[model samples]
Target: MRNYVGAIAAVCLAACGEPGGTDVSSAPGALELTREADGAASGAWGQGEARVRFASRRVESGVYRIEVRQNGMSLTGLVDAEQGVSSLDGFAEDNGQDTQMLDGDRELLAGLYAALGAELPAGSALAPELKYLRRAVGLWAEHPPAVELQRTVMGEQGRGYTMLCGYAKCNGKFTGSCGTTFNWYSYAKHDCQHGGFDLAANQQIAQLGDHATCDGDELYMSGGKWVCGEPDHQSRPKVQGNCFGRCGPGCGGDTQYTVDATNHDGCVRNGHALTSAYCNDQFTAASDDELYAPDCY
Candidate 1:
């Protein structure tokens, strides 16, 4: 999924600033998707500067024209429910003063068109048709969870450390893959001492270990030792007070917050693995590391 944090930043840079100059400190909050009695739908996030408006009017039997006004750009698409197709027909800017061919990812517009055509009744009023389109737009506009990163910095006089420091490194890595497998194992009674004997001849059984001597991909160093095991982690110092910041007036920066380091459970956001929830969850999925019986270890 495309990173919408960048989108919010773009909107803020364009409109969210101190009255005279461009200076912004806050990030946008969740999108506000709303519908009007006229069946027109609008979604605004990142304050009100970044906005999208959807309006549709039925043409004839299972066909409708969709107009999307997003920020300063206007996109038009046609939906034919009977044919099960949606296509971007035109694009314009500055209230249609400048027109150009539609380009780039028009899936959002097409999806909205198809959804509207399928849901809205024939000859239905504009308001009801756009209401459904609003929901689709809202889903597409849903923001990923805001992640907060904590960095350690020495306090003045080298006394203590502050938990929240600097920009908080908004962009961070998500969990990829994880599973603790042991390289340690034991063999049972195998009488393969003779060259004529098979390697597995008379091997009763095998044993596994609970502790991970080394991972499958770990390389062996001198003295037959693993390069490393699970690295040790230091516990975080207890934070005394809450840390909260607000966005500038009329900006959508309020919905943005830092994600704690421990919330990676593999759950998805915006149809993408933006967090480490999946891999982290796998670490605990199977608690029994020993493949064989406990006594076999």
Candidate 2:
């Protein structure tokens, strides 16, 4: 048995913004392998703005294989600061295992050639009577499962993170390899771990503790945590407003609003306002750190 593994990472953007975001879109269809000529093959796929190629080889009599091996992070625009690294590996093998043996007859080779979309030769070890064998088996072998690592920013602040990594084996038995595996992980600003946080809020304020005020009001009493703003209040301060001033509209976190008493308010003490308003830094930073890894088989 031969051991094989490969990785392919891609981030297809619509020529507008970052590699992984709402604006990004993926092209239809998966990568494919095909015979280019007698005893020759090719593998083709697209990633970002470029095309990628893998090497193919003829291993034995009537047996061919193709392989691409690499870490998912190496690909441009595939991985980013917030997104962790990933990998993929697999192989493609084609052998006439299902076809009946032709006892060293050249006619058997001719049939194989026809099955691969090649013109039959005038004279060969295989006879014209055995030409039907060519159509019996498909040209390319079954591809092994490609590995995938999908990293997503979770939670209201995007402070929470999760990575889903898995492998999907091919369905055909041309080779013995086939199956799937999945793993998950979570991380926060202080420490990278496993799990997530569920937040709660009311119409006026997002109360993580005792005390209430309008969203984006800069809760001096609440240790400076930013609120996501009330959905019902038209005047509610923007959530993740920190990035708005710096990154502009092209970056994540950009929106406008009308200030109203129901949504706007500044903390006050002794007839004077206290703490100045500031957006949550964590959410804005995380939004800028969109990253992704591809699935390859």
The number of the candidate with the highest TM-score is 1
Q: Write the per-residue lDDT of candidate 1 for residues 188-249, one digit (tens) a residue.
A: 11111222112332221111111223332112222434343211111111110011110001
TM-score of each: 0.26, 0.16
lDDT by candidate, in order shown: 0.26, 0.22
Tens digit of lDDT per residue, candidate 2, span 1-297? Answer: 001011323322222121111221235223434443453433333333443333333333332222221211111122111223212122111321112112221222222223223333222343211221221111111111121111222211123322111211121111244321111111111111111121122122211111224553323222245433323221222222211111111111111111110111211111111111121222222222221111111
* Alpha-carbon RMSD, candidate 2: 24.7
Worst 10 residues of 1 by lDDT: 288-297
Off by over 4 Å in 1: 1-48, 95-297
Worst 10 residues of 2 by lDDT: 183-192
Whose lDDT is greatest here? Answer: 1
